[model samples]
Target: MSRFQSKTLCRVGILAAMYVPLALFVGIQFGNVRLSFGSLPVVVGALLYGPLEAALVALVGELLKQLLTYGLTATTVLYLIPPMLRGLVIGAGAVWMWRRGKRLENCRTRCFAVCILAAVCTTIGNTLVNWLDSVLYGYYTFAYVFGDAVYRFGVGMLNAVVVATVAIPLVVLLRRQRVVQEVKRP
Candidate 1:
């Protein structure tokens, strides 16, 4: 592989390693609240490397978390798919927006815009996945799932907003550090 490809693979591996423990700790502690810095890695990996890398990181991270913590419950595994999809969709959207001159390099406005976009995209993706899961499991009617969808959307929106506001800035700060830069480049 070329330098870029090697770097990308390394990044994906590192992200998966870092995110698994962190996400599991947060997931176990926070559960549905999900008030952790897990998404930051996905966003940063996406911005620095690429969406595919970010998606890989997100998926592997969640899988590892589930394996370690819950020993792979069917429900948990099923729920993991949505966040994986959400990370992929949000990362792709963020990268696309950045490449199209969104300029989230240092501008606060650009960063906030990117965050908002991520929030919306992830929220929609997550809601859709939950709705599908509800349908598949036959836990609730379409109307009930629809109501739950609204609740999930609202919570997801809040989570995204909080993550964007807090986690993105922290990721940016970490990115500026020499350690993070070396990791990104290597």
Candidate 2:
């Protein structure tokens, strides 16, 4: 494989590895919601590697965690959507910012904004997934679904906060270490 491909895979592997343990142990799960810093590595992967690689990292990491925690079930497939969306939206946003010449190291405001955007998107995605899961599984009635959506959105926001808290420092560190290189001039 080429150097770039190898490096990207390595990043995905390492981040995925980190995500499983965080989700499994460090996170809290109440009912259908999982709030953890697990996705933080995924977001960091997105920032460094872009959406596809980040999505891969999230998918593998979250799938492994779910497999271990709940075993292989139809729900597992349904559950993957939120994290994948999280990675895709966050990673894509970061890449877009980079492509537009926003140096994360030098532009703290832009970095914070990107992180917030990622968090909001992740929250919305998670809320939607929870809503779909409820409806598809017939787990609740209309009133409950609405309440659950709101609750999940709140939980998702907490998760987003955790993701941003972890991701921002990690990104800054990567930039300092020169692991996150400058975007090429267009």
The list of candidate 1 runs beyond 4 A from truth reads 1-3, 27-33, 69-81, 93-102, 178-186
Q: Candidate 2 clash total? A: 0
Compared with the true structure, model 1 gives a TM-score of: 0.70
The best candidate by lDDT is 2
lDDT of 2 by residue, 1-186 (tens): 998778767777888999898888887887877777888887787777677888999899989988998899766777777788878877777777777766442455665566666666766665566678787778856676566776776677667766677777788888789976543333
Per-residue lDDT of model 1, residues 74-155, tens digit only: 5666656655665566556556666575534356566556656666666666666667767677775776556555565566
Predicted structure with the largest TM-score when compared to the true one: 2
Clash pairs detected, candidate 1 = none
Error of 1 at 150 (Å): 3.2
lDDT of 2: 0.74
TM-score for every candidate vs. truth? 0.70, 0.81
Worst 10-residue lDDT window, candidate 1: 177-186
* Candidate 2 residue pairs that clash: none
